[model samples]
Target: MRRKSKCVLGIEGTAWNLSAAIVDQSRVIASAESSYHPVEGGLHPRAAAQHHATHMEQVIHDVLAKGKKNNAKISAVAFSIGPGFGPCLRTVATAARALSLSMNVPLIGVNHCIAHIEIGRWLCNVADPVILYVSGANSQVLSYRNGKYRIFGETLDIGIGNALDKFGRYAGLQHPGGPKIEEIARKAKCYMPLPYVVKGMDFSFSGLTTAAKDALAHAPLEDVCHSFQETAFAMLVEVTERALAHTGKKDILLAGGVGANSRLMEMLNTMCQDRSAKFFAPDKAYMKDNGAMIAYTGLLMLESGAVLSVEDSAVRPNYRPDEVEVTWR
Candidate 1:
């Protein structure tokens, strides 16, 4: 058999996004992403699954269309294996497996969180650093130590983004409320103070989010938004600083959707520079949920002969980033 450079088609249908990507050995050639329509309340699992089922095929087609435009053909298939809503993941997995079998290619399964970290490393090109993952469903400060990504700190109640979104919803904002809150916050003044909760290297946003919402009920909307942003950003900054101090790892990389916050990025950038430490965040495309990251991770894993079978495929809603077995290429 002739050996060929590794390429993988990555499919990621986690919570709200249905994404697909084609990655060659060197880089991502093409990608597609589709987000869930607005649900009245928070994530409605059945509705999310329905969205995935409806859009996943289109996402895959668009990804392949782009790849064909670039004359890139994948060698294998890879799908995010877990730490997401099971129904949504199953939709992607079914698509990936079907393609893999029909194309007579190997299939690789990737942990969504690990893929996030891997994409951060790929973009930042950092050797070792503390990684802060702040997304809709998770918040943690992690480091690769002792052969695994060790969690140094995490949320005690709700993830930062979740808390923010909940508060935004309570304020009569649209779904995926973080951006709406940030938009309102830009015009607001932070005259009122909010609590900043940072316990050791971990941070809590539930209290702050509650306080912000309550304040809005009695205070100006703009003021409440501004106060919320200031307090939440400060808490994140403090915890990040503490993680750096505790681990003695000056290098820090931010990943996931919350990493796109301008205020948060600016604060961390200044702090890192002042402390003579490095700080890195991926471009907006990589920061938000996408298939490119999964494709990139799958490319590496495929190159290392890490492939899986359909019978063994499963989605884990609670899969931790640190629990994945690492295989660096």
Candidate 2:
């Protein structure tokens, strides 16, 4: 008799995006996502959750259809369990539980932050690199030690992405302000001064955000954006370099949605080149909040004998990356 193919189905609804993917041990078979854009402000937890609830079923079906795999071949279901908006996390978790129970497959709860790092590591083929995680909701320098990915440095206030978005809002940019800010910043010929705050190994962006808002009242928008990127990326690079120096890690990986910024990548590449360390980042597909990363990481966890009962698959909106045990490593 021929052996049956086994795959894991992963769901990711951490924030604005509702995504799903099917992954076999070797590669991702299919991935699908739907993003919710706010009309005038940042993502509202309840509203985002409602959007996920409305579209999640269709998204899952689309992913499964794209893979062309039988549901019986799925051996596990994975969901990003947290460090996300409460309502969004709960909505995803509930869907995951229903699927797991219906299929009689194992349920796995993945850490959203860790999934970002794992996908970057897997795609880039980097082992044990210091991670610079910068997303809309998170900013941290992380490294694996003993059994967990510990935070070497982190944001004391707003994350880099959030700071950029808030600044964009103040300038009347649309939702998801990072990309808009980046676009305008590229046209700037001069960089205006902005607050650069890095205390010890940690960094803060609230002050910089405030300063940028104030500067916008007097300074040109392009100059302000340019200055903001320079100052913000500098803080991130500084802390990441410090972490690399302290950990002596020969590799540095950039993960998360904000990793898509060219300026940030350039800064990191320069720092890594100066230090003679390898720099790696996944393709844009895996950089943002996506289901493939969650699926792949979940597959690793399941293969390592980690299991979650349906009843225990509750969401943890405040889940920290370091709290998860690095069993695959």
Write candidate 2's Cα lDDT for 220-239 as tens digits. 99999999999999999999
Residue 238 lDDT, candidate 2, scale 0-100: 95
**Best lDDT among the predictions, by candidate number:** 2
Q: What TM-score, to 2 decimals, does candidate 1 have?
A: 0.94
Tens digits of per-residue lDDT, candidate 1, 198-263, equal 887777888888788778768988889878878877777777788788889979999988888887
Which residue runs does candidate 2 get wrong by more than 4 Å? 1-5, 69-72
State each model's CA lDDT, in order: 0.84, 0.92
- Residue pairs with backbone overlap in model 1: 83-316
Q: After superposition, how far is residue 91 of candidate 1 from its true place, in Å?
A: 1.0
Return the lDDT, model 2, position 304: 90
